[model samples]
Target chain A: MDVILLQLLNGLDKGSAYALIALGLTLIFGTLGVVNFAHGALFMLGAFCAVTVQRLLSISFETIDPDKVDFLGNPAKVKTPYVESWFGPEMGGAIVDWSVPIAILFAIPIMIAIGFIMERGLIKHFYKRPHADQILVTFGLAIVIQEVIKQFYGANPIPTPAPDAFKGSFDFGVLLGFDPNAVIYPYWRLVYFGFAAIVIAAVFAFLQFTTFGMVVRAGMADRETVGLLGINIDKRFTIMFGIAAAVAGLAGVMYAPINSPNYHMGMDFLVLSFVVVVVGGMGSLPGAVLAGFMLGILESFSSMNVIKSIVPGIDQIIIYLVAIIILLVRPRGLMGRKGVMED
Target chain B: MLGLEKKDTSLLIIVAILTMFAPFILNPFPEGSALAQFNAGYPDLMQRFVIFGIFAIGFNILFGLTGYLSFGHAAFLGIGSYSAVWMFKLLGYNIIPGIVLSVITSGLFALLIGYISLRRSGIYFSILTLAFAQMSFALAYSVLTPLTNGETGLQVYNSDPQYFHSENMPNIPHLFGAKMQGTYSLEMGPWSFDFNTGYYLCAIIMLGMFYLAIRIFRSPFGLMLKAIKTNQTRMNYTGLNPRPYTLAAFVISGMYAGLAGGLMASMDPLAGAERMQWTASGEVVLMTILGGAGTLIGPVLGAGFIKYFENIFSKINDTVLHQWFAFLPDGMENFVITIIHPFVGKGWHLTLGLLFMAVVIFLPGGLVEGGQRITAALRRRAGRSGRSGDDASSTDTTPAE
Candidate 1:
């Protein structure tokens, strides 16, 4: 029971990331009918946005402290952040500590602007192009974006610590009446899981309740009919694109604290998210989310030492193995709508 | 002469002539000159140009003809390399058996993968292939270490069982007795040319493969594959099974990739898991698309261009850039160098990405189409009165659409 619960929690973190990215991929595919290979770059950009904010917040000036002697036997130089000088040391220090969370607000507009520009500028020209062209162009864009980030940040992963409050692990096994140290998990992972749940719910709710989302949903179902209804479905779809980008951005922003932000991290996730999207069935939002979690749980379970000992490398290929089986047995995928990319 | 049509025969002759004298053509600059860095006539790079040409040519047979954009063709290349290296380790250093086994094994692998992956069409097919390739890569990188030798990569070691080992033979991969890396540098007054046995051998194979690709493009099976690409439903209604045709194309391309990979190992005996990664797969796709997918000569041209750019452009550093622009004023030169520095040397990938995007966006039919457009426009300007001439026969030799 402890092992299962532990794996489940572990699964949720990976599932959240997969679901979030796949959700955005499905959104773009469903609405604008573009297969966005560069969506991952947007996620990377969002993480970098957090990095940028942290850097911006902590921009500091050096001054010599006469009280502290340096290693060279001179007065020590003390660096004070500009935020500390501006907002007073305590408040500014607190803000710096919580920059990763605060970056959510900063990334939203930037991501939305990026999405709008991407849709309006490059992707708009590729709307009538072949799927191959769309894929190639976006892949090229992704490479360019990652390369730019690599140039600025270097190739090393940048550590972005979570808030001090969420630094420690929670003993779930003890909470559930098992041994104390049986199934301890980091607090931030739980926070990430909760955050993903809320984001997924908000997106679902917006689509369910709002007229704009209804039109967007209709557009996904039958684009011609929605367009013939004298509705400007394109504008709504563009806004949906922005929303999708924002969702992916927010996911990356939070994930920065979990895994250190690296230029290639988005690419590493993108491939798996693509697998999740395919296994969930293309353009199926709920299917994507469902498969994301299912695959995540499956992946987590397979990675167990017992399973590894049995299969001797099953963990490395379990997701793909499962994907192949599912795709062969049920071509449309679990929870997939009829005739959505069936051809 | 080789069972080719008149136009194809001429193309074959032209390509043959070009490959035969590549050392001369590629090495335009004099020895020890500043522009010598731009020369790509070296054996290693020349081998790559033709080897990748073969790979791209094979990829084009499927993607260009059948319109099935495979995102995992590099797995076959990796498989081929592994098999070839194993042959070298198990058998003697002779390349014929290694190359033959590589093609056969990769063909079988392709047959199995294609059988399953072809169950779906379009993006699903691409995803399925991608999944299989990624699985292979992951397995090779971690679990399959015994067979693959894992992170250190499979290489010819001193302790490997060499039942056919002889004191007189070279340790590196060889053909019968001739060393693959043997090069004879001819120093002509100003220009120097390196004639490598390995490059010539690869060149011959590439020409043979190119000839085979030409024949396949003109064959009835090729037309059938193109027909499927045009409308699979229509072909099915006409009582044609597109499955066998696509599978055959897939297998053939896989073998081509295998042959390329074998040749790669023949030149330098090492096979890494990175060869099977999706990025490598993307490269062949880029090569095919950049050259003009369906055209007989396009893939080769694309392969050469990309390989050349990777080799030559990457060699240009800020120091070199500064030297080139030293004729300008100090401030202006420094400004220009700084701006230009990022897109060259280690930043060549950035330039490549930008160039790839521009090509996909602006020239969808690739460099061939771009060349055709220019020639057509020039002809129109010269004649001024001809109704865009039925020269479509010349330009549309192999239709990409």
Candidate 2:
């Protein structure tokens, strides 16, 4: 029971990221009628934005120690990082620590702009094209974005540490009157899970409570009729696209500390997310969130050693396997409406 | 004049002669010509061009004709490769049996995959095929490592010991005393012609495939497939069951992929799970589209073009750039070289992506359409007599890939 509980906690954290990204994907697909294959790349870009912010915060002028003497040496030694002096050694160090959390603010506007540019510049022209063409072109765009990132950042994975405050694990079992190690979980991952819940709630509240959100939801259901009523359905759809991109970007920003950011990370998540979207029922937001978390937890549980001893490589492909089964059993997916992606 | 409707029997003779003497025509540049970056003369890449051309041409038979986009076509190619390589390991390098086993094996694999996947049409069919392909990829990567040889891929060794015809064999069997890559060349001032025997073998296969494709394109079955493409429901409502016809078309295309895969193995004798990946599957689709899907010759052209670009693009270096910009200012030239540097080597993907995007955006019908547009424009400028003179032949000039 303890092991299961621990796995469930771990699973929810990872599941939160997957759910957030997939929710954004389903939202975009519902409103735009275009499969955004580059959503994964956008997530990756959001993570990179966190990394960039971290670097910027850490940047400082190097000081030359003129008093120290080394024969024929330039200024004896070059003292690096005036950060120690700018905000004092301790505070300067800690002040620059909130890289990922700070990145949320930076990423939103950037991601929104990127989303708009992507729609207005490239994908807008392809709305009338076949799915194959859309897939190919967006796939090309994904490659271009990934390669550009790789060229700048190299192909290696960059580790983004959470703030010092959330570095340690919390023992939940002891608090609940169980043994100490029974339900220990990382504070940051738990924090991430909570953050995801808040964001998910915020999004739902906005959509269910606000006029803009209502208009978007209305547009998603029947854009043709909305357009007939003299509303610019295209404008709403474009804003919805921007919102979806920002959501995925925010997920990536928080996820930077959870998973080390890498260039090809986007491609890795792409196929799986598509499977998630399909499994949840295409264009279904709540279904995407539910299915994403369910599959993530299932995948985590499947990877347990005891489970692996039987299926051998079940962990590597459980999501896809489950996706296939669900798609077969329910052709419309868990909550798919009629005639979505039917053709 | 090569009339559009004429049954040109000489086309066969020409193809045969060309295949027989491909090496002599292909290998003239002595390894340093401007076009030296491109020597279809190399047996491995050349065999790839023709064989994959055959594969894409076969794919065109289904997708181009029936308008059914089966995303899992690479499964057949993978099966074909696996079977051929297994034959080489179990039997001998006698590619005849290898080719035969691969065709049958891939045909069966296709039969199963197609049968299950074809139950759903449109995007559902595509997703089913994708699921099957991913399943195959995963299985090959992990579960079926015994057969697939896992990540390192299937390879041959010297001590594998030929089970048959071992007496006079030197390593693998060769055709008529000619090794696979044995190049023969002749040179002039700025041009050259060279050839290899294995190229002739591949050319023979390519011509056979092209001819077969043309025949299929003209046949009644082909007409039926096209009808299914235009309206399958109409055909079904009219009392014609489309399943067997589509199944047969699927199997035929799968066999073509198998043949291509077999030829690929025979060229270099290795089969890896990478060939079964979705990306590899996408490449064939891209080739078909780039060359003009449904056109017999277009897919072949696209395959050749992409293969050629892939090989040439990777060879470009800073020295090549400096050579191009030798007359510019040192600082300006250095800047230019640095700017252009990312496009070569590891950055070949950038160039490819740009080119792919451009083609997708503007040339939906592919290069064949571009040719048509140019011809139409030329005819418009050529006065009143240009209408029937060239349009008929121009329109029908698909290479029958």
Candidate 3:
């Protein structure tokens, strides 16, 4: 049915975001053994990176045009973006139009640097503390980060529109022999899903093929043994933390157009992403991705009219209900190893 | 006195005196003075101080004693508020019935949630509780709109069934005929003090709850709870099931949260779903930790400290900052204001977050421990100067685990 297909498409963008955030959370938890409650703040910072890029590109200076007259019969003051003047109107306009993509490049290093500072400055000291303390400290950091963002951007959601090319929806229903409007999907959302798939694949490949990844995986399994083997496993773990931060940041950057970048968007996704990580089995990468998509689809399905009619307001609480049921039924999560935070 | 230990009795008396003379103690600054902005002796804020103190004390009973960090306690508080408002709608504006119903309903809700959530410990327990709370919040915000009144919140209306209503009864929430909002202000010279009936009622309740907390801390059951915190595995091996003890603590804390919520509704006569948000739950946790979790007087102190700062800090703005720094040179004043601007008013949460992190990192034992450390250092100096350090070392008190 077109409805089912449409729902699946509806779920993918959100699912990709959940997968991306949960993957990062699991990475930090796996390598550093720190529950970074501020992980959502990182995702938020990534979206802000796109906002920053767009703002930077559109920096304009006003000039009086002698040929044009204003309504008051004075020479018109025309504003031209610095980028337009520097690169010529056509090229500069295109660059500005694609600021969201341009932000991906800018966000990577910035996010990684942030990750490094966060680990080295703050989270490094909390390694031997209780999990509760880690959570508390990170939670404090999240609040601080959120407040800082709110201070800068104000509390309102800033719309970060995608490129002009990706503005409209693609009629998937027509391609699949259904009516034109039946399976309509946004172009940017499809791009987001494809982008997520590539990133997930690249991360998997890097882990599977690289020696550094092997060492990190070994360290994850047994830190002491890796340390005993003369490997600087701690340093590798830190880099992995940066990578995880980059992944989450990229997710945020791409997600800017789908939903306006709000200061609290990170927190809104955070609770659910955490649920995703737990349901996927903590420290399990594949499990995080699978659970992310599963929950996302389930969420969309619950929001369907038929489902809502049967269970009123099911959409509001379906994710949490599923998380609760999953947590209760499968205590260790889907792919969690025995004795991994079992106590 | 009152079946309390000597130290606890003194602490209780001190708290009683402080509450009794709060209008004076809290309003040390005279009316219309530069420091008047810092005064928190108003009925609304003073009421909040005791109400939140009760919530934190209850939280401490669970988290401080058992080391089980719950992140869903606000759900109980919200439930209490809703139940209390319902009582006001059904019965008259009497707070007694509302308060009772709130505690009962929240207790039952906590029992159900605790029974399910207590199956796991550590982060899982926290997440489970959080999920349940979020579910409650979502339900209350939407489908349960009829019960919760949705976004408009639950408030008493003229058309509401008030079977016990009388023509002579006060319209506002009251105890018999004593209005909760009734405040008697006394102005003398430059200073003014307000004696609020609602504040006194809340203060009395907070003191009673504080006393109960102290008793719980000192009881055999308290020791058992601490033991569970220490090592549940060892307790299990010793033939003791920690589940029942933990569930009881959870229920008790939930009831405390509910009582606070009920009190809140009784004072304001409205209940909203935002009260159930996780941030509200986190506020209680922050209060307990910032005060010194597990310490008898810490939660109350923490509650007061946070509430006082939140009120004072939020009231400050750019104009207030300029007034304070007007004596400085123009450039210097501007610089100072710029530096201080981000940590006040709308930026209060930033300061709170930074302070919370610092407390967690540098003073895990919280403000109580910090105070104790300072006193010990001062006594050491005094002893060294007076008695050649003979009793200085012996006077050093180790923090309670």
Candidate 4:
């Protein structure tokens, strides 16, 4: 029971990430009818935003310290960050420690702006083209974005540590009435899950309760009818694109400490998130989230020794196998509507 | 000529002339010169040009004709490589058996994948193929390590059985007695050219495949595939089943990829799982699109263009950049090198990405269309000038078509 619970906890963080990215993909598919292959690059850019924030906060200037002597017998030099000098050491130190969270504030606007530019500049032109062309153009954009990031950050993964306060692991087993050390979950992972839940909820609420979202939903169902009603559905759809980008960006910002931010991390997540979206039924928001978490748990479960013993190397290919079987059996996916991409 | 149309015969002859004289044509730069770094006539790179040309041609047969974009084609290439290497281990280093086995195996594998993947179309088909490819990659990388050799990659060891081995037979891959690596270099006053046995073998095979592709393009079967691309629903309404035609194209292309992979292994006797990665599959798609998909000569041209640029662009570094800009003032040279630094060497992919986007957006028909447009414009100019003279009749007889 403890092992099962532990694996479930383990699955949540990764599942949250998949759900977040798939949600964004489905949103763009639903609204703009564009398959944005570069969506993963957006997730990657969000992580880099955190890296950028940390680097910015840590920019230091050197000053001579007369009281201390160096190893060379000269006066020691102290390097103090601009943040430390401006806000005083304690507050500035706290701010730097919390850079990953601080990045969310910066990433939202930046990611939305990027989404706007991408839609207006590149994706906007591909609306009337074939799906293959849309995929090809966006794929090119993904490669360009990934390469540009690699050029700036080099090819190595950069570790972005979480704030000091959330550094330690929590004893979940004791709370669940199991052995003390059976289910030791990290504090940050719990925080990530909560953050993901809030974001997912907020997006749902925005789409459900707001008049703008209602218009966007109407546009998704029938763009011509919405346009015929004299609603500026295209403009609203673009805003929806921006919101989706922010959601994906937020997912990446929170995920930085879990996995080191790397240039190719986006591509890695991209293939899996795509499978998640397809399995959940394309253009279905609730289906994407549910499928993401389910696949994440299944992936973790398959990686267990018990499962591996039954089917050797099952862990590496379980998701793909499931995806294939699901695709073959349920062509439209779990919640797919009839005639949605049926052609 | 050779059962080909007049235009196709000329195109075939042109391709033949180019491949046959490649060593001379590609090595235009003199040996040990400042521009020598740009030459791509070496045995290894030449072998790749033809091998990839075959791969792209096969891909075009499926994607260009049927408009079914598959993202799992690299899995066939990887399977071909692994089977070829296995053949080398079980039998002798003779490439004939390895190449044959590779085609059969990859064809069977493609039949299986295509049967399932062809059930859907558009993005769903792409994602399905992508999933299968990734699954194959994962399995090859780990679960099937005994067969694939995992991270170390599959290579023939001394202990492996080679039933056809003999003292007189070359240990490395060979055709009868001719070693694949054997090269004859000709050195002139300032020019040098390398004629490699492996390159010639690959070039001949590529030409055979190219001819076959041309035949396929002109056949009634080819028209059906093109019809499927145009409108499958209408074809279905016309009482034609598109499934069998698409599957055949998919399998044939898979065999082409396998042949290329087999040739690759024959040249260098090693098979790695990385060859099956989706990025490698993406490379073939890029080649077809860049050259102009559906055009007869486009895939070969695109393949050669990409491979040649990849070789040349990656070789350039800061020192080479500075040397080229030496005539400029020191500060200006430094500035130029810094500006050009990101688009060369390690940054070659960035340039490739931007180029791909520009091609997709501005020139959807690819380089072939661009060439045709330029020729048409030149003809128009000549026609305009000739209209003022007595030669106007000759100009009017030959329209731009």
Preferred candidate (lDDT higher): 1 or 2: 1
Residue range B1-401, candidate 1, lDDT tens digits: 88888888999989999998999899999989999998999999999999999999999999999999999999999999999999899887989889999999999999999999999888778888989999999999999999999999999888788677687888888998899999999999989999999999999999999999988988898889889888899999999889999999999999999999999999999999999999999999999988998898889999999999999888998888988999999999999998988789888888888988998999887888888889878877766775555454573354556
lDDT of 3 by residue, B1-401 (tens): 88887777888899999999999999999989999999998999999999999999999999999999999999999999999999999998999999999999999999999999999999999899999999999999999999999999999999998999898999999999999999999998999999999999999999999889888888899889989988899999999999999999999999999999999999999999999998999999999999988888888989999999999999999999999999999999999999999999999999999999999999998998898878778888978787654443321112235
User: Model 1 chain B, poorest ten-residue lDDT window?
Assistant: B389-398
lDDT of each residue in A268-338, candidate 2, tens digit only? 77777787888888889898999889988998898898998999778777887787777777878898888
DockQ for each model: 0.81, 0.50, 0.91, 0.90
Kindly indicate the candidate among 1 and 2 with the higher TM-score: 1
Question: How accurate locally is residue B350 in candidate 1, as Cα lDDT from 0 to 100?
Answer: 89
lDDT of each: 0.90, 0.80, 0.93, 0.92
At residue B176, give the lDDT of candidate 2: 33
- Give a tens-digit lDDT track for model 4, residues B1-401: 98987777888889999999999999999988999998999999999999999999999999989999998889999999999999999998999999999999999999999999999899999999999999999999998999999999999999999999888999999999799999999998899999999999999999999999988888899889989999999999999999999999999999999999999999999999999998999999999999988888888989999999999999999889989999999999999999999999999999999999999999887888778667767777877886532332222112111
i-RMS for every candidate (Å) is: 0.9, 2.2, 0.6, 0.6
Poorest 10 consecutive residues of model 2 chain B by lDDT?
Answer: B1-10
TM-score of chain A of 1: 0.98
Candidate achieving the largest DockQ: 3
In every candidate, how many clashes are there? 0, 10, 0, 0
lDDT of 3 at B200: 97
Question: What is candidate 4's TM-score against the reference?
Answer: 0.97
| DockQ-based CAPRI category assigned to the predicted complex of candidate 1 | high
The regions of model 3 sitting more than 4 angstroms off are B388-400
Q: In order of the candidates, what TM-score does chain B achieve?
A: 0.97, 0.88, 0.97, 0.96
lDDT of 4 by residue, A101-173 (tens): 9999999999999999899888989999999999999999999999999999999999999999999999999
